[model samples]
Target: MTSQFPNTLTPKMVEGIKGFNLCTFLIGLEGWRRGLTLKYYSDINQYSDIHTQGKKLMGRNYSLQSKDKIHYFNQSRGDMVSNEAVRIAQSKQKTKDYLEKGNVNILPSKEFDKTHSDVDIIKLAREIGYPVIIKPTYGSLSKGVMLNLKNDSELTDALKYVRGQLGYSNVILERYFEGADIRVYVVNNVAVAALRREPPKVTGDGESSIEKLINEKNESRKDNPYLAARPIKIDKELKDVLRKNNYKLSSILENGKTIMVKNKSTLTQGVDLYDITDTVPEHVKQLAIDTLNALPNIIHGSIDMLFDGEEAVVLEVNASANISMHMFPTEGQPRSIASFLMDFYFPETKGKSSNHTNMYFDFVDIVNTLKQNYTNYVEVKSLPQPPLYAKKYIVTGEVQNVGYRNWIRRQATKRELHGYTKNLKNGNVVVVVASHEKEKVDKFKRVCKKGSKKSKVSDVKSSDWTKEIKMGFEIKDNITKKKKEVDKKYINELLTELKETQTKLENAKKMQEELRMERDSYKDKLSSIRNSTSWRVTEPVRVIGGLLKGKTKVKN
Candidate 1:
């Protein structure tokens, strides 16, 4: 089985696994947990090389020299999809052509270049009928897509926006189909999951204004992992959508009424996903599988369609990267598409099952790895080198007292590299790395330059030093005796200050208790005096004296 699939890894998978790219991380985590050795190169120094030779690294780019062959993945999509398949699927016009050729029911669409006049484009839409959709020829995540163009003015405006605003030279106009937006994820010509993507909407509560309702709806989505990053915006598009429904930002809607706020059903635009896998018709599943089979060398991807009653029309096919709708549907059982992908990559482990909780890599480990070596931008390419190499590095600038040593140690251990990271007296970090693979060593140096999240690394100087370092990596205690003495003095000073504070606190408590006792004694003495027989006898004499004084004053 190892000989059949072969071990593989991608740079994107390594760097992205540490960051917010959940799709890439899920696939990489699944592969790592399944016992496949993964290697990646994401240092800034290698960016130029990767950028220049990116095309050559496509489709089974490198083979891992493992004893057993294990299939590797790029992003979450495995080797099942080919470079050609991704290219064709990226273009809307090209995808429509292939679907039509496969006898699939796709909406009639016409491709137009920027040179086409508004008259020509509007004329084409008229022929296709009113309520046509205009979108960029090549795009994803529903960017630059306009729907429900019911007039020449609307079509003309959409063309300008797609061309002028979006800067897309090529655009496609298609007949608009009204139905529930559905997506079917297929793996190896088998439908594994289905989702119904509904446009972002807010239900009216009868009293609150439309804007207030939208705010409430967005607030509810703030805690969702997927929805938090992509909230509905009150932009021009949203305003237009509301206006079309005879509403505005200030409109107070009737109770139970719901209005769609966006034209396209994209998850990034707050679209809701409903898992319809079990309830989806067999014919619909077959159609999704057939759509993938229609494309050459495409075994895994999603088929987007519009379904009305029992009939479904193909909207588009995405092979470049699979959307994560199945993993976190808003209204249905969340599916583990990551596990499914791992099963496809490593077929030998299909029957072997583990606890569901153990299937994912540790989140803390992933975060630490990211903090050590991850950058916001990572390209999908490979580094040109053998499995093992060695290097020594001197990382300067804010590298001390920031947990940099522990971060580098964890990074080396995760990559199975032998290296030592220690703090120098000069406030620099020195690292000696030796790995069986050169890419691993390169990645280590890159991570050192980035340092931990708390450390600010100014520069990283590297040199070849395989001959000097021994096997296994450890953090060497290189602090001088003088520095240790200084540390001890600082600790003593803190201890003295703490003791003084404690004594002051105790003194304050004692004074408070004494004050309370003195006040209570005074109260007791006053009560005793008031209750005495002498006081009672003096009360009657005082009253007689007061009356005599009053009588003398009246006579005077």
Candidate 2:
């Protein structure tokens, strides 16, 4: 919604922020509504908040201070500190103190015993009992965690796994909770967003391999900031889950099938964060605020919660929560999280709700939704490049006429770069551009390679040429011949192979079915054998005794 943040910081970081919707959240709703521009103040060495931009425009500053001694510099109002710092500082606490408070609740936790080895963890497990959780003392976002320890062997495995993952010298073990996890975002003693996040689940197609299916899911999340945190790994746990479900990695899953590889709501477990904004009842919101207030130095964080019926337990609180992705929800678009932050930061805006509301509805909301979906919706125009320096970019592969060329044309024109895209007879795409401002041109070329859906660019070559073109950006007519379809002979051969593979698959299914029947038949016989004491003890004992005595004499 807001203009793509200019190259205020390093381009990569800016780009990263843009991709993750971080800058969008920072700007807030009022910023969007008023057409608040993000400008790089050449005067200050650091990034300024909303006020500095206003000062540059109005040729003055709006200053104000609060009871807490935090400063805000503005255009109409000038410098001073505010009371917000005091509020933020009040809610902070040391991680150790927070962990020690676990005794307040029945759930178990411990300080890492510095002198203890893996064996000590085992001893602690025995004392505490089975099915415990092992985690790192200094960790965030479920970085180093393990669950489901049923016995001493499993405890050892969990400890080893946790230690290896964290590379930590010591770790804490706690009781594992069997319930849904919720993250409640609290700001100023009120619950803003209460989300119920679930581990990612997918319907099986009864054809593709599990590994293949996982690849598809992961790739689909390339544009998702949080989903990218989870990487697919095949380990013993994955195998164990398959075995427990009576499935093999080779087994084809049926449609509408769901599988959970990990239990926790961590991104590594492929978490699906649901927007329960409307669903969170009043009591639940109060409970979350109450839980945070109970903890020290814990404002502006997410409460880790597990609820059973009406009862809920607070696992922990995260100070630096990633509100960007959570704000721009995948489903059920709610009020902007940025709106809350802006109003919270500038308390004066509280009384001006009508003004802010008009801006939000009139400008910010609709424009942001559109820009988020398509970055190019707001075109950026570039300044002219001089003859001394002309930038040229050559891109190859299935890029031309597949929407890539059009994208390049738009970006080049916006950034004020002069470029031409053409299709080669060999089907490769070549783009040449000359502009005075090369950085904008370079950015254009970069975006061109990663164009919209359906553009599959493989190779790109860029260079600075002395030659310059006076004309503005233009889209040259470029077309490539389509590849020939498979011949009849090849098609027949492929069909035959497919039929053979299908037949083999059918036979494997039949074999599995037969094995199941045999297993059930053997299970019945074993049940009868266990129940038949007369045959098992009396008959067998007598026969064995007679054979032992008579066989001894017969052998002599």
Candidate 3:
């Protein structure tokens, strides 16, 4: 079944998958599940025939091939996204104009080029009204976005910071709209999900200072998969925001008080996401759908808006790349946007079970594939001979724990062979070698023939190793130390399991106690009702009624 698809696993694919970008990984996973041959092409390694001109390539791009048809993707956005749409989306001014033409409510904005003077910017700001936003026309991740510039002086300084420090040539001034920062993801003219994004903030615990509280919050962010690596930065902008709120890092906040740490709502900048797909108004959803339809050749995109109760104003349209906030939302139900995208890309695969857990590739295999490709790339660039030769050697001798594995690793590394040496359970050492040069593999095998000083090499069996192997040489230990480490790991696992069991037991006991208390309270209520004055007063009536019922039964 695997051989039915084209081999898309290459060196470039490895580099693309090794990053912290969840979107890229998710896309790769989706493609793999959908039966598409996914390949990563790294420009750095000169894989996929990318011209580097002796310069190091620094990034990896992706391609999904379905037989004869192939689709290229960068990040989450794919070939479906038009270059014109991307250009318009990159410019805030263009996005606003497009939204306005579509009858979507948009904050009034004025565009400025590098040639624009500060006076011209201030004039535009005055026209837009006070408390306007100043931001780069073509920027992302909330970088170079300055909110609520009240006066000309503030705008002047912000413009200088954005232009001089941030190096943005184009800028826009728009009326600041304060409300929920919501992002609606639309695919194929349909709104799939929506999320309300909140800027990074901390709640007061009464005891800890604001700075301490922020630090604690940042530490807690490490638990969130999306936020783990990206912590909220403590910078001048944050301090300015605090000062504006009449507080500082040293200020102690009262219990239950909440303070915003950043001015903009950007997930990369630690913004929190709340899935509001089910609750977002139909009109808002329609607005997002309309916004996407307004732009040509945009099969999928995200519409960032500010919902100010009365209306949802389109803030920007992101067509080039957008975060998958709906997938890993901080609150509310997660939406399967990846599945939706896959279905959109391959409509015939819709309704077929593509469970992510069941379709994942082996991590080690991916790493090895990448390594082999990289080795080939380097050999092509630097070595005179092509590097595609590989061999696996199994030696039966006194090789267990005699440092034979390390010796094999040194030998392979010296020849630039990418593979690993492991101690087999049968007291034999298995060494795998992968190289483009045949002599290198033969040389490595010859070196393995003479066992290390502490061991004896009885027989060396060699075979062609055509499978992908890891980069560099690695020594796999099956000695007492490795066993001890494994034992320790199991012990930790057992301890964790015990702790979880204990917690469940405690919760069960607490629940049992609450149930008993409720049962007792109900019993007491029954006893009180039986001993009530109403019961006493109606006792003779009850006796008379019983006698009458008996008489009626006898007559019948």
- Give the TM-scores of the predictions, in the order they appear: 0.60, 0.51, 0.62
Q: Which stretches of candidate 1 lie over 4 Å from their true place?
A: 1-20, 43-67, 351-556
Candidate 2 residue-wise lDDT, 346-410, digit = tens: 56445332222211111222234343543222211222312224556677777756788777778
**lDDT of model 3 at position 152:** 84
- List, residue by residue over 301-384, the lDDT tens digit for candidate 1: 888888996789998887744444566566777666766766776776553333121222223343444346554222222221
Report the candidate with higher lDDT, 1 versus 3. Answer: 3
Please report the candidate that would top TM-score against the real structure: 3
Q: What ordering of candidates by lDDT runs from best to worst? A: 3, 1, 2
Evaluate residue 234 in candidate 3 and report its C-alpha lDDT on the 0 to 100 scale.
Answer: 85
Q: What is the C-alpha RMSD of each candidate to the true structure, in Å?
A: 24.2, 25.3, 28.5
Estimate the TM-score for candidate 1: 0.60
How much is the lDDT of residue 307 in candidate 2?
66
**Global lDDT of each model?**
0.70, 0.55, 0.72
Best by lDDT: 3
Worst 10-residue lDDT window for candidate 2 reads: 1-10
